[model samples]
Target: MKNIFSPIEQIDNLDAKVIAGIERLATLFKSSLQDTAKRYKLTPLQAQLLIFIAEHSTKLCSVTMLAKEFSVTKATASDSLKTLVNKSYIEKVYNPDDARAFSFVIVDIAKPMVNELTHFGLLMSSSLSSLNENELIQLCHLNLKMLNIFSQSGLITCRMCYSCQYYQQKNGGFYCHLMKKELPAKALRLDCPEHLKSS
Candidate 1:
């Protein structure tokens, strides 16, 4: 296996260097998450669960769904949910659509913390401040391309609109081919359960 964090100079190809940089950035971001989790007296998985529930819509916030989204087993998802519930960070409620099912809701006490965690990327914002708007857009495209490659390799899966086969762009607007409806750019989901990998 290739060492993703090897020194950029040692890499002969520019693309390889860029991939290494992305890996390095991800490492640093995860380190930040670990630090934040430590301060809040929660495990990293617990912190991630809080963020996931906070970001997802109520209908999509169930333990079974989370297990699938996070690629973890049902028992692992239940354990993490249990920890969050015990800490009063989230609560399970009966699913309105299915009486037999339940979903999670972030508690009021956790709202502010969840908001803070959402902006944790700000820790590395300064490093990207030098990039202009066009550069940022280009970087975004490159990152998406790399994400697709990783997904193909079974290294990771992203449920973002751009990664879903349902995603479509038409007449300067976005649409969901699967849903057969026009979708607003702002409404694009980051953790959609309906996501199907683009071919």
Candidate 2:
């Protein structure tokens, strides 16, 4: 029996080692988010929803999009949104494109809490800061490539530049035709408001 959690020396396969490393990082993120959520008296999902609504555009903050983004059922997402609304952390704005639909927006009163909630990723960012600039760029590229593969397989939905129709690979670099700008490897976005699925 092979265990990826075994000592580094015991895991000879590089791919398994990488998976183990990612598992460890996932553990760290979960713990951090849980701790923050507890401090604010919010469920992990509610805290996550609040933080995501603060960061993303309103159009992407609806129950349907939130369900897809968080891999939760629409009912679960809607319930969480209701909790946030009750807590006065978010408000529903009628969608202009669809009057029957409403999207969420963080309320002014929750700005401070959202600022604190966003700190959940601070430690991970600090850890990555130890790498050289080139290494950071390379790591970003690798992560985007891996995310694209997962998105293509329908394992998860990602609104990333690499999967957007406007994304272009030119002269061994990246360009966004919609933005009409060259994207440095480090500037590749994991989420963009204007992302459109590529055919």
Candidate 3:
């Protein structure tokens, strides 16, 4: 009997190779990130958050929201947030909408640190010069698709790049308008870690 709803073979041998290559890419990036982060005294998670905040400086972000987005416990997020706050990397903001809530804005002084991470993308692109544009495009498409699949499957919850937010480009990249005054990149989070979501 013919199977009416059999699954199709989407990933073939070549696809497997591509997947392997993607895994290699991730490993290499992670390794490099760890080394770079160690030199700068930051963890991979911190680097990710720093980049996010630097790129989205204009927007407001909360530790609770960050915890949920990163699939981390609120306590973990708060702990990490506290470290950043103490280090003068991220500042906290109070919410006018709800005094009980707070938001985090990145400091411009940390731009140099953020730029270090950006350099990785440049390095990778230059190293993979042999790969044609179309191939690179295909790889990006597939990788994004795979990420979506994982996120949808509950492997991850969020996949947003803070830099891609709307507010970052505004306010000269510091203290999103939500804050009463222009706070430094590492102003101070309110007692609470809840506030409005920013771009």
* Candidate 1 per-residue lDDT over residues 34-83, each given as its tens digit: 88888788777778888888877766678877887677889998998998
Tell how far residue 26 is off in model 2, in angstroms: 1.0
Worst lDDT window (10 residues) for model 2?
1-10
Best-fitting candidate, measured by lDDT?
A: 2
Clashes of 2: 0
Over 32-106, each residue of candidate 2 has an lDDT whose tens digit, in order, gives 888888887898889889989998898789999999888899999999899899988899999787889999999
TM-score of 1: 0.75
Please give the lDDT score for candidate 2: 0.88
In TM-score terms, candidate 3 sits at 0.65
lDDT of 3 at 59: 36
Off by over 4 Å in 1: 1-9, 13-16, 152-155, 163-166, 169-199
lDDT of 3 by residue, 1-199 (tens): 2232222332344555655666678898888777777777888878777776666433336886677666788898888888888899888888788888888888778788778866777887798899887777666555555664665566765432222122233366434344434534333232222343233
Off by over 4 Å in 2: 1-10
* Sort by lDDT, top down from the best: 2, 1, 3
Q: For model 2, what is the alpha-carbon lDDT of residue 12? A: 71
> Model 3 Cα displacement at 123 (Å)?
1.0
| Local accuracy by lDDT, each model | 0.78, 0.88, 0.63
